[model samples]
Target: MSDSHVTPPPPSPSAGRRRAGTTAALIRAQDTAIPQADRAGSGEPPTPAQAFDALHAYCAPALIRQAYLLTGRHDRARDAVVRAFRLAWQRWPEVAHDRDPAGWVRAATYDCALSPWHRLRLRDRHPDPPSDPADRALQRALLRLPPSYRRTLVLYDGVGLDLPETAAETEASTPATANRLMHAREAVAACLPELADPAALHRGLLRLGSAERSPAPGSRDIRTAGERSIRAWTRCALALTVTVAGATALTLETAPTHYLAPVSPGHAVQGLPVPGSLGPLSRDALKLSTKLRKEAGGGPERLVPQAR
Candidate 1:
């Protein structure tokens, strides 16, 4: 909503780099800070749109880097962030009211980026290796970890989250998460002996992230996409509801107002005009009619019954 609270990342890669997960202005602007004007009187809360804008501006850049670490592919990382924010915007009520809006978005981004489903995509199948040999080695090691283990390692080590926090975010018990983190470290150590220390592994992960440029979509772009998605879904639901209602109304209009007793079938009488039309003749009736016609119309054989 205002530029004072929303400071963007340093423009150029050459400008200066901080450790991963450092957003320049986020520390001061934490938890959707209220403006002086709002805080002065009435204690009015910022509108949903205002709150969403503030949250996105605060979280997006750092999240982009984290997503890059989660998925090595730049495009996939970008898509995951955009998709996550789009979802966050759509579910703004739940996200805005949550204790940690940033964490909610982070979890969504991680889930999207870490999904095994991305591996099936044709273009993303090939690996994009970093130019630096050490970075390349680390990337290979990270990829080798199982999705669960990989996620746990990134959360606990790379993002500076505690064991319980990582466990909660990954939806795993703390003990299981600890096991995953331990196994992940061992696996990475097997690849590169220098990363044996947890601190060194953390630095390695950050270096790997910084080496690759994360292509996170703009906050405005994500918000617009979310709004467009909501509009499409709303229109679809409305159209379906209208169609059902119209069908019901049409059925009601054409239906009978009252009941009438059903009538039985009728038979034909010779030389007498029936008041109403008779039902269609059966095969035997038609044949008998043909035989009677071949003889006299009023013959005694036709009138009298024969004893078998």
Candidate 2:
């Protein structure tokens, strides 16, 4: 008889989300090593530039791996890696001067991962969700852990940061961070048997980073999406300002009508009846009135409506 072949089962939805979230978190953390403004700067020093290039050659792969191990999402990892390199270029002076640049990068990555924004994303995925009975049990165990404890486990056990380094990154006292690290280790150790093997996990991370390097067919549209997101954020702010100005204009335009509408017998419709050039007071009054009307929901829907 021919040998029976067994194909591996696919990951469950919750498991996939957990892996994706972790990978996303790690990549984002690494990206944080570089600052944003520095990415757009043009000036360069020849020697420093050479050093930056060399440092990036070594750091990029390690950061990519660290990101994959933290997050399971390929696209996010790529973006994070690019962003991290940009940041490293900006602060080459201080970073190159560090005793251990690798250590500095690791510390930067951890802080980014530990940020509130990253935590919120991970929490939304709930890394250990209740899908299978094994997953359920794992989720329960993880839930019982404190945030600090979880941070310690991911930093020390997952990425291999030492106790002292982890402590400095976490900002807990050396003793306190060490204590948290110990508890995190214990918590994860108790649950490992119920989860996939660490070797299997590592392989999956490598695949994630590689997948990012070479995106799948028909997904190149992501660059368009990135451009659109930047435009959208910019336009949203622009729209808000225009909305405020438009509202002010409408109020001012209509203010004369309001006062003119309920004029007592003595008070005449002052100023030119033909609606001549508006004086500064009239203009200012019109602006103020438009603002009030907009505030009162009397304007166009282009504005994000505020509470009355």
Candidate 3:
């Protein structure tokens, strides 16, 4: 990996053209999040950083809220959004060209927030309940529901995504999404009878989602961290490649060049020392030779002496 800093390239012309049709006001974004100096040249498409800033500014809050509804926790919700944007910045070109950039980020956020691993954390094992009694009950109901069902309900009802869109985002068929939504609504309504009506349930979800607000991350930091993450992974891959190449070289250096025939097992040979046996004593060698001469033409046991 090179030590040189690399700037993210500008979006393609097609992506830039989308910005012409989009206005910050359309998304109800509060801040440009980009400094005046970072502004693009007149009539040119916004830079990657600028586009990311605009997207982050617009979608983060809504995604966080939706995440809170999905996970029923503030910290997890915030973390999910931050991680999603970091991933978006890492794959800036894909995200920039995506038909629904917010949806792309939203999918990533939901996956992060709903990961089963988070449930294992001591911090996340138990979260503080909302202050309002109704909100508290609603969140508990949402938490009681299964993860897939909870996600479906939140995306469909809380985020107002149509059935087909929800199904696509959740990667389930439309029928399956509808089934989960139905089950989830039934479960929530079972806990809170007053929310039996769909409109009332939607309002309940909105109240629960809006009960808490986690701060949105700065786009600049997210981009920097994304780049840093890429650099770190690149370094790790380089180090692993170098290690593998070094190991291969070492093996080649020590390996035998030609095959040697194997010694047959269980074969006996005369005058060969036993494995791990020491050399014969000097006095014993002479005595053994004399004994052998005297014992010639005798029993086989007398022809050879024990090595010891």
Best-performing candidate as measured by lDDT: 3
List model 1 lDDT by residue over 1-308, tens digit each: 23233332112222123323443354455444545665567767677766776777777777888877777888888888888999999999899778688889999999999887887898776667789999999988988888899898887778777766777999987667777777788899998999888768878888888866755466678788889999999999999999999999999999889998789789866897658878999999999888877765445475766679
lDDT of 3: 0.79
By TM-score, rank the candidates, best first: 3, 1, 2
Question: Which regions of candidate 2 deviate over 4 angstroms?
Answer: 1-46, 118-151, 194-308
Global lDDT of each candidate? 0.77, 0.51, 0.79
Better of 2 and 3 by lDDT: 3
Model 1 residue 233 lDDT score:
97
Q: TM-score for all predictions?
A: 0.69, 0.42, 0.76
Clashes of each: 0, 13, 0
List clashing residue pairs in candidate 1: none
Candidate whose TM-score is highest = 3
Candidate 1: lDDT of 160? 75
Ranking by lDDT: 3, 1, 2
Q: For candidate 2, lDDT tens digit of each residue in 97-208?
A: 7766655665565445434565456433444222345434443554466756755655554455555566776776666766665555456557664335444433433343
